[model samples]
Structures are given as structure tokens and as C-alpha cells.
Target: MRILIAGAGIAGLTTALSLHAAGLDEIRLVDAAPEIRPLGAGINLLPNAVRELADLGLDAAVGAAAVPTTELVYFSRHGDVIWREPRGRAAGHRWPQLSVHRGHLQMVLLAAAEERLGRGCVRADARVTDFCRLPTGRVRVTLAHRTGDTSTTTEVDALIGADGIRSGVRRVLFPDEGPPVWQRQVVWRGITKIPPFADGRSMFVGGDSTWKVVAYPIAPLPDAAGLVDTNWAVSRTFVPGEVVDRAGWDRVVDPAKLLAALDGWVFDSLDVGALIAAAAPFEQAMVDRDPLPRWTFGPVTLVGDAAHAMCPMGSNGTTQAIIDARALASAVAVEPDISTAFVAYERDRRERMTLLQNCNRALGPEVVVAMADRARSVIRPGPSARDLDRELAEISRRYAELGGFDVAAANAASSYSVRRRPHSARPAQQPAGS
Candidate 1:
């Protein structure tokens, strides 16, 4: 079957790989970008995502570019430790959680897709305008070049919109849905050189209202330096009806304002002020969205951010997209009828995706504030280690259960036996600078 996938980001690339693995041929993937470049900052790969990557034989490539996160440390505004717990392999999961630059992840996926699927399978610089279903059951996709000098049309057995939050296909299918509902939160993220604090793999710190930060080491510095290239995001609630200044997307922020937001927050050991200061002129924003009821329409379906773009609170965006790619691919492999395959994919994914979206929204505020409160009193010097351990264990268990990682299903879907080894072998190297 010939398939047209829109967007070349994580979702789109994964979709291509999954379909190919399912024995589908004649795949055409398109992206609006004139050329693929390293974009975005950093991403946390949960165990579920790691399993999918492992299935694709890209685990080593991803691991080489990532810092194996050992623990998640929660803090209060005053630099108090609220809670800390092991992550990924250390947390008893079979797979390890990874922290890596978003660009690095995208590049890894793109390179793998292009190499295995062939260059002709992926197309960049083509922006899909819309798609229409033919009476004969085939789908016709219309695309135009941003340069305004070129246009093309393609007929495919199916279409998948992995186009991201501002997806054109979604608007075309659900016009009455209007614009995405803002979750009243703005976020800013960037990467910078910084010395590793505590365990280098730790994520989340400085839980406080108005200001909070999630930080992790993405890759080691290039010179084998002690400092790791860290990534972080700071977010706050947006005022009602505030007009977002598009020009200010990359605006530098005042360190004082950023620090003041966490003034009395009590989290863990990390210095909130020092970290924010280190993240000078931080990129900022208010962003999030309400859940969508459906992600599939006829033969065209949505995946990843396009289907359910929520706040980055729960490291589920990328994981959900990867899962979607696998699930949709599996459905198509089983159901010969394109329409039946699309319907089956949506029926299985929409509920889970919606649940994840709601979970992220519910956890957003607590991530920044609850940990702050816990940090205020939990990490004091000379505390009872037994008591602290118990508290930390409870928090870890609660979060693990609430995170919606269906261990049974994840394990079943993540059978590595189904994956083929890469054609070329390479030695595993330490993250950039080690």
C-alpha cells in the first residue's frame, strides 16, 4: 500500500519506519522545512519510548547521544530536596530512560529512516495543503512548496498527519474544532554548558508557583570537560487573554524575574537562582492544549503532537507518538482494508492518548509546587534517612502508577526479537565528550 505521511518530525519518521517494518511499500513522507536541521532543545525518553527505539534497532544510536538518567530529583524554590528516585533501568524497568537533545533524536531517526527506506521515501520542503478521499477509496494529497513556484499531487492508499500542533490536515478535517485551546501556561527552553549537579541524569527541580524548571544533562561537553551541555525549561501561568508576541518567542528573560518566581520554593539541593542565572536570557512561553476526541478521519489519521499536544509536564509527548506509530502500523498490518485499519488504530489510541493528555494537565501545577513544599522540610541536614526513604519510595510508586505506563502492554509491544539489526555495525561510544 502507498502511504503519504505529513511532517518529518518524530511522529512522521517513526510512522515511516513502522509502516516499512509492517511490509508496506511505496511510502512518501513530506515536511514543510526546506531542509532538516537540528531543531528544538532536549527531550526525555521514557522507558516506553526506549522500548520502541530498541525495536527499531536505533537504541544504540539514541543511547550514544543521550545521558542515561539515573534518578528524578524534585526540589522546592529554596533549593530543598523534596524527593528523589531512580529512573529507567535503575528504577527496575528493562529499558533505560534517556535525556538527549531533540535535534539529535530527530537526526538519528531521520538518518535511520532515509537509510533503510531509501531517500525517495522521504521528502522535505513540501508543505501539504489538504487531502481528499476519492470515490474509489484512494486518497489524494495536495501539497505546495513554500517558495510558491512548485506544486505536486500524490495518490496514496492512506494518509497520516504527524504534522505537529499547528497541523494543516487536522484543520482541514476538523474545521469546526477551531484553534487549540491554550492551557494558560507559557514555557521557555534552552541548552547551555553547566557542571553536573548531584546525579547528572536527574530531571525536575525548583518546584514553585509562577516559576519552575526541569533540567537534565543532554550530552557531555565536546572537550571531555567536566561540564555537560544541559537543557532546561521554565514556565509560568499566562494572564487571561494576553496576546503572545510572536517576535518575543526567543526573547531573553530577566534573571531576577525568573529567580523571584522561586524565591521561597522548597525543593531539593540544587540552587534554583544559580541554575536560572546560568540559563541567562532564557527562552520563554505560555503553551498547552485541551485533549482531542478523535485523531482519525476516514483513511487519514493523526499522530503525536498533532493528535494530542499537551504540556510537556509528563514526558509522554514523544513516547505517545512512538506508540502511535507502532500501533497504527500494527493495525494496518493486520487489517487489509485501509478504512478498517484506520478505524482500528483510532479506536485503540484515542482513549489512551486522551488519558495521557489529561494526566499531563493535572500534573503540571503539582510538578512545580508540590515538590517545592516537600523540599522545604524533607532535605534538611540530619534528617531521618529511613523516613525520607519511605517518603521517597511512596512518591516514586505513586508517580509510576499514575504515569500510565502499562508495563504489561509495553512489554508485549516491545519484543526486540522482531527487530532486524542494522546493516552496518558501529562501536558504542560515550556521549560526545564523555
Candidate 2:
């Protein structure tokens, strides 16, 4: 079957690989960018995403490029420890949670997809403009060149919209849905060389819902002065009706301004102000769309940020996208037809993504930090210390389970890999020569 994937980002690239592994070889990936470069800052891949990468036979490469995170610790605005737990293999999952630069991970996936699917299988400078279901049960996708008004079209058995939050495919599918809904929060993300904190392997999240900072080492090697390359994000929520223009990921923001947002937050292990001062960060408004009633419309379906864009609260945005790719490929390989596969894939992922979207909106596991801060001054006897500890752990545990990264379920979860069948390779489909 001829398959075309829109947006050559992590989600789209991984989808191509997953489809190839499932024994479906006719695949093409197109992106709006003229070139795919190593860009962006650090991102955490929970054990669940790591497992999917493992199934794709990419675990070794990814692990090599990233630091295996050992634990996650939540801290209050005053730098008091609120909750802490082991992560990845340390948490009992077979796979290790990895912290790596987003650009590095994307490059790894891009290399694998191109190697397996051939150089011609992936193309840049071609953006998906629109698509329609033809009478033959195939999709006619319109492609517009980035350089000029020139456009082309191709027919494919299926189209996967992994185009991210501002997906044009999603726009044509739900034109009236409008731009992503900003949650009145803004985040400044960057990586800086700083003294390693917490054994250089722990992910630290400090502050509460209104304002918070997350930092972790993305590299395994430490430089002189015992410093390691650390990734950090400082996020703050504005007033309910505050105005925040939807910004791209590449917008630069003043590091001083980000440090100012922290309001003098410093932990015994790390000083967030120093971290921010050490590097410039790109700024973006934290935004997401409401869960759609359906992601499948005939032979086309949405995945990743296109189908269910959630706030980066849970750090599962990339993880969920990778899972979507795997699940889509699995369904397509097992189901009787593309239509059935689309419906089945939607049915399986939409619910989970919807729950995750809502959970993120509710602050996910980070809610515990806010709760702990509030509990500091409770003259009225509420829950005891032990009860509160259980409650805090439960909050974190529930979010992990919902994201499919909880230790028990993740360790026991069956692989998403589909058995490969003997099939002849076919070149990617394209419009007739210009």
C-alpha cells in the first residue's frame, strides 16, 4: 500500500520506520522545512517511549546519545522536597528513561528512517496543503512547495497527519477549530553548562502550577569544574485573561527575564537563577487543543500533537507521539483494511490521549508540589503526614499509569512490534514528472 506521512518531525519519521518494520515498505515523509537540522533543546523520554524505540531497534543508539535518568524529584517554591521517586530502570521498568537533546534524537530517527526507507523516501520543502478521499478509497493529498506557489498532488492508500500542533492537515480536517488554545502559561526552554546536581542523573522539578522550573542533565559526560550540560525550563502562568501571542519554538527570550520569573528560587542542590543566566532560552506559550471526538476521517488520521496536543506538563508529548506511530502501524498491519485500521487506531489512542490531555491540564503529577505548599500552614487538622505522603505518591503514580509509563504495566506491556511478512519493496509514490 502507498502511504504518505505529513510532517517529518519525530512523530512522522518514527511512523515511517514503524510502518517499514511492519513489512509495509511504500512510504514517503514530507516536511515544510527546507532542511531537517539538529535543533531544539532537551526532552525526556520516559520508559514507555524508550520501550517503543527499543522495539524499533533504536534503543542502543538513543541510549548512546542520551543520559539514562535515574530519578525524579519534585521541590516546592521554597526548595523543600515534596515528592521523589526512582525513574526508568531504577523504577523497575526494563528500559531506562533517557534525557537527550531533542535535535539529537530527531537526527537519530531521521538517519534510521532514511537508511531503511531510502533517501528518496523522505523529502523536505513539500508541505501538505489539503487532502480528499477519492472514490477509489485512496487519499489525494495536495502538496505546496515552500519556495513558491507551485503545488503538486499524490494518491496514497493512507495519510497520517503527524504535522504537530499547527498542522495544516488538522486545519483542513477541522477548519473551525482555530489555533491552539493557550493555557495562559509561557515556558522558556534552554540547555546550559552547570554543576551537576543530584548525581547528574536526577530530573528536578521545582515550584508549583503558577510558576515552575525543570532541570536535568542531557549529557552523560561532565566537563571540568564538575559541570554537566543541563536542560532547564522555567514556566509561569499569567492572569486568566492575559494576552499571549502564539509564538513559534524558535523565538528567543531574554534569560534575565526568565530568571526574574523564578522570584529568587534556589535549591540546596541547584540554583535555578544561575542555570537560566548561563544560557539563552527559546520561548513559547504553552498551548494545546481540546480532544477531538474523532481523529480518523476516512483514510486519513491524526497522530501526535495534531490529534491530541497537550501541555508539556507530563513530559509525555513526545512519548505519546511515538506510541501513536507504533500503534498506528500495528493496527494497519493487523486490521483487514485501512479504514478499519484507522478506526481501530483512533479508538485505542484517542481515549488515552484525551485522558492524558485532561490530566496535564489538571497539572499531572506536579500537582503534588502545589498541594504540599498549601499543606504547610494548615491549622485545621487535615490528613496526617503518612496519609499526605500516600496521597502525593498516588497523584504521581496515577499520572504515570495514565501515560503508560508506570513500572508494573510498562514492564509487563507487550511490545507494539508487528511481525514482518515477506514483501517486495516499492518506490514511494509521487505525482508525474513536472
Candidate 3:
């Protein structure tokens, strides 16, 4: 079936790749960016996402570009250890949790998509402006090209909106849904070349609900100075009545300001302040929208952040998008019609993504840090250390299960890949390199 995907970011590109694997090869991806550049900070790919990549024959390439995180540790504001657990393969999962630069990961996916979907499959400086469901059971999509004072249109069997939080398709679907709802927090993110800490392959989160610092090594190896490229993020919830500069949310801020905000966040091995001070940082308001009742609308549908933009409380945003691509592609391959495929895809994904949206809003596994902080209070009798650990472990376990990354579940889960249908629309085209 002919398909047009809006936004060539991770979600859209992955969707194209997944569709190609499922024998639905007539696809095109249009992006709003003037050019595809390697940009952005680090992102963590939990084992579930990695497993999908493995099925797509991309595991080795992505693993080579990332550091396979071995563990995750939580610390109180005072630097006291709250809880610690193994991760990825160390946690006995079939795949590894990968930490890589966000831009690098996108480029990796883009390369794979181009090789498999043909070089002409993606176009830059073009974006989806609007769409209409034609009577012929197809969707006619309008595209606004950046080059000329012109616009173009095309009809496709299906249209997938993989654009991010401020998706144009989403805007058309819910024109009244204004800007994304801010989560009342401002985050500063950056990467720095620093001497590896804590086994050099682990991630850590410190502080409480109001504020926290997270850091992990995103590079697979240290440089000549024995320093690894590390990614760090510092976030603070806004105080009541504090003014928010929404217009300046995407601006780059001075590292000194970040250091000031994270003052005194020093640990025995990790110094949050020092990390921020050493890197150039970009700041943004942590924002997401309420989950919609449905993501499929006739011949059109949404995926990734467009479908359910959730806070990154548990590092499941990217993973969920990858999963969405797989599920949607699998449905398209097996379902008889585009509308049926979209419905099946939505049925399979909507409930779980909605749960994740609420879960992240509640801080997901990071809730453990706040729980530990409360337990450490001297104002009243706190839960015993043993009891606290049990509770914290349970919270983490629930979140893992909720996010579809539970070790047992992920390892034993059926594959998302699908066999090419016997009655495909046409024979698969030769991949670019092949």
C-alpha cells in the first residue's frame, strides 16, 4: 500500500523501516527540517527498544554506537543511596539497554531506512500542512515545501503522523488543544567529556521530586584523557507563582546558571554541578499533553509523541515510539485494509501508551527517589530501611512491567516482525545498497 509519513524523526523513519520489513514498501517520509543534522543530547534505549532494533537487523550497529548501560542507581538529595538495580543484559534481558547521543541514533536509523527504503524515500524542507479523507478510501495529504512559494498534494492509502509534540497533523485533529501542557518543570540537558564514574557503564538519578540530576555515559569508550562522553540533565519543578518564560524554552542558557541551580548537588563520585558547568547546555520546559481517546481517524493515524506525548520520567518515550512502529507495521501487513490496520494498531497501542502517559506524570520509577526522601524524614517515624527497600523495589518493578520492559516479559514476548503477506500490493523493490 502507498503510505506517506509526516516527520522523518526517529518515529517516522522507524515506521518506514518497519513497513518495508513487512513488505509494504511504497512509502515516503517528509520532514520539516531544512536538513537532517546530527544534533541533540543523549537518550537511553531500554532493552525492549533494543530487541526491536535487533529484529530489524540493526542491533550491532546501534550497540556499537552506544554504551550498554549495566545498572541504574538512585540517590537521595543528600547523596545517600536509595536503591540500585542491574540493567539490560546485566538484568538478564535478551537485549541491552543502550545510551547514545540522540542525534547519532537518529542518523543511524536514517541510514538504515535509506538503505532499505531507497535514497529518494525521504525529503527535507517539506512538511504535512493538512490532509483529507477522500471518498476513494484514500487520504489526500497536502505538503508545504520550504523551497518555493508553493505547496503540493498527494493521495496515499494511509497517512501516519509521526511528528513530535507540536505535530501539525495533531493540530489539525485537535485544533483546540492549544500548546502542550507544561509539566511545571524546566530541564537543562548537555553532554560533557568527563572521567568515567561508577563502573563507567551505569546511570544514576539523584535528588527528589522538586529537583533531580541524571547522568550516564553515552559513549562506548573513553578518550585519550580517560574521559567518556557523558550526558547530564538537571531539572527543577517551578515554585508556585514563579513566572515561566515559555517563549525562551528552547534557548541555550549559560552553564553558570545551570550550576547555580544545581548548587550543592555533589556526591562521592558524581558531581552534578560540575558536570553541567563543564558542558554547553540547552534548556526546555518539560511538557506533554493529555492522552487522546483515539489515535486513528479513518485513513489517518498518529504515532510516537504525536499520539501520546509523555514526560520522560522513566525513559520510555523513544522505546514506545519504536514499539509503535513495529505494531503498526505488523498490523498493516496482516490486515486486509488500511482502515482496519489503523484500527488494530490503535487498539494494540492506545491503552498501553495512555497508561504510560499517566505513569510518567506520576514520575514512574523515579518516584522511588521521593519515597526514599520521605522515609529519611526525622519529623516522624519513617519506614524501616528494610520496608523502604521493599516498597521501592516494588514500585520499580511495577513501572518496568507497565513500560513493557520487564525482564521476563520482554525476553519471552513474541516478536513484532511480520512475514510479507502472500498478496502484497507488489514485489519489494531492491534496497538502495543491495
Candidate 4:
């Protein structure tokens, strides 16, 4: 079947690679971006995602470019440790949680798509305008040039939308969905070269929802000064009704304002102030669409952020996207017809992502901090720190399970493998490397 995937970002590119590995050869990718620019800050691939990448023969290459996150630690606004736990292979999983630059990861997936599917398979600067189903049961996708010139159309047997949170495909499918639900929380994220941090590969999340900080090294190895590139994010929240008219947030912002909020967030091991001071910050509105009723509609379906743009809490946004790639590709490989594949894919993914969306809205394990805050009360105390730690550990495990990262199960299951790679899927002469 001829397949067209929109938006060659992480989700779209990975989808292309997964489909090729599944033995589907007639696949093409396009993106709204005018060129292949590796844009964005750091991103994490939980064990679930890393496992699938390993199945694609990408573990070593991507891992080499990423910091294997050894632990996940949480702190209160006052810098007191709330909970801590080992992560990835450090936690006994078969795969390691990867903290890599999002742009770098995209480049990795893009390179893989090119090598495996042949170059020029992904058409950049081609933006999808609309789609229509032909009487023959094929899809006709209208592509407009980035320069707004003459438009063109391509016919494909199937279409998958991985176009990101503001997906036009989603708008076409759910016109009344309105704009993405914005939480009025703006995230200031950036990378900075700083002295080695805790464990050199641990991830740190500080403060409550109102104000927060997340810092982690994306580089597995340090540089000349024993320093590494660390990604730190600070968030500023708006009071109710404050962001109703807000329009843009994913733009560069003055870090000075964000830095001030970290005035006293310094820890003996981490200097939040220094990290903020050293990096330029880019602001992003914390946004997610309400879970859709359905992601697959006939031969057309949605993937990744296009399907479920949940809050970037719980580190599930990207994780779920790659997971979508795995499940969708697997379904396509097993099902007899295109429609069944789409239905099976949706059945396999929708409920889980819906639950994840809800869990992330509740802040996942971060809710434990709220519990701890209530614990300080004189009348009705909440869980003590010791008890909170135990509770938080359960919450973490629950999310791990929901996110498809059961340590024991993953370690025991046969390695995630591509069941097929039809001859047509590979070019006669692959570049001498992956």
C-alpha cells in the first residue's frame, strides 16, 4: 500500500522507519518545515521507547548520543528531596532511558529513514492542506509549497498524520475540537554547559505546579572542563483566566525573569541559579488537546502529538509518540487489510494514551508534592516524607507500567523485534553504515 506520513518530526520519521522495517515499502514522508532543521531542546526516551529503538537497531547509535539517565529525583520548592529512584538500565530494565537533544534524536531518525528507505523519501517544505478519499478507496493529499505557489496532490492508499500538537489533520477530523487546551503555564527551556551534576546522568524536577524546574544532562560524557550540556526548564504559571487571550509561547524569552524565580532554589549539589543564569531560555505554552474519541478513521489515522497532545508532564509526550510508532507499525504488519490495521492500532493505543493524558493532568508522581504540602498542616496532616516517598515510588511504578515500561516483563520478554523486512523495503546498496 502507498502510505503518506505528514510532519517529519520525531513521530513521523520514526513511523517511516518502523513501517519500512515492517516490510511496507511504498511509504513517503513530508513536513511543513522548509528544511531539515533539528530544532527543539532536550527530550527523554523512557525505557519503553528505548526498547523499541533497540529493536530498530538504533540503541547503540542513539544511546551514544544520549545520556543514560541513571535516576529520577524530585525536590520540593524548598529544595528538600521528595523522592528518588533508579531509572532505565540502572533500574534493571533491559533498555536505558535516554536523555538526548530532541533535534539530535530527530536527525538520528531522519538519517535512518534515508538510509533504509533510500534518500529523498522524505519531502520537506511540503505542507498538507487537505485530504479527500477517492471512490477507489485511496487518499488524495493536497500539498502546498512553503512559498505559497501552485499546489500539488499525491494519491496514496493510506495516510498517517504525525503533524504535531497543532495538526491540521486533527483540525480537519475534529473541526469543533477548538484550539488546543492551554493551561496558562509557560515553560522556559534551554541548554547550558555546566559543571557535572548529580550522578552526571540523573534527572531532577523541583517545585510544585505553580513554579517548577527540571534539569538533566543530555550528554553522556563531559567536556574539557568536566562540564556537560544540561537542559534546564523553569515554568511560570498564570492565574485562572489570565491566559485566555494568550496566543504565542513557543518563542525565545528573557531568561532573567525566569532566573529570578530560582533565587533560593539552590541545593548543596545543584545550583539552580547558576544553571538558569548560564542558559538562554525559550518559552513554550504548556498545552494539550483533550483526548480524542478516536485516532483512526478508516484509512486515515493520527499518531504522536497529533493523536494525543497531553501535557509534557510525566515525560510521556515523546514516549507515547514513539510507542505509537511501534504499535501502529506492528499492527500494520499483522493485520490483513489496511482498515483492520488502523482499527487494531487505535484499539491498542487509544485507551492507554487516554489514561496517560488523565494521569499527566493530575501531575503523575508530582502530585506527591501536593500531598507533602498538606502534610505540613496542624489539623489534618498528609503523608509524611517517609510515607510520601513510598507513595511516590508506587506512583512512579504505576506510570512506568502504564507507559509500557514494566521492568521485569520487559527484561523477560524476547527483545522487541521487527517480524519482517521485505526485500522491497531495502535498497540494493545501503550506505556502508546505519
Candidate of highest lDDT: 3
> Tens digit of lDDT per residue, candidate 3, span 40-147?
888999999998888888889888879999999998888888888999999999999999888988988999989999998898888888987765667788988878
List the candidate numbers ranked by lDDT, top first: 3, 2, 4, 1
Per model, how many backbone clashes are there? 19, 0, 0, 1
Candidate 1 residues lying further than 4 Å off, grouped into runs, are 220-222, 238-247, 250-257, 260-269, 280-284, 364-368, 371-434
Q: Where does model 2 exceed 4 Å of error?
A: 241-250, 377-383, 413-415, 423-434
TM-score of each: 0.85, 0.93, 0.94, 0.92
lDDT of each: 0.71, 0.84, 0.85, 0.80
Which has the greatest TM-score?
3
What local lDDT score does residue 15 receive in model 2, on the 0 to 100 scale? 89
Q: After superposition, how far is residue 26 of candidate 1 from its true place, in Å?
A: 1.0
lDDT of 2 at 177: 94
Which of candidates 1 and 4 reaches a greater lDDT?
A: 4
- Residues 1-434, candidate 2: write the lDDT tens digits: 88899998889998889889878888999898888898778888989899899888898998897999998998888887777899988888899999999898899999999899998788889999999876666789999996876899999878899999999899998889989997778888888999888777999988865788889999898977778999988888787777655544548877876666674788657988888887878888788999998898767889999999998886799999999999988887787666677788888899999999998887788877678777763223456756778888888888888999988878876557766756623322332111
Ranking by TM-score: 3, 2, 4, 1
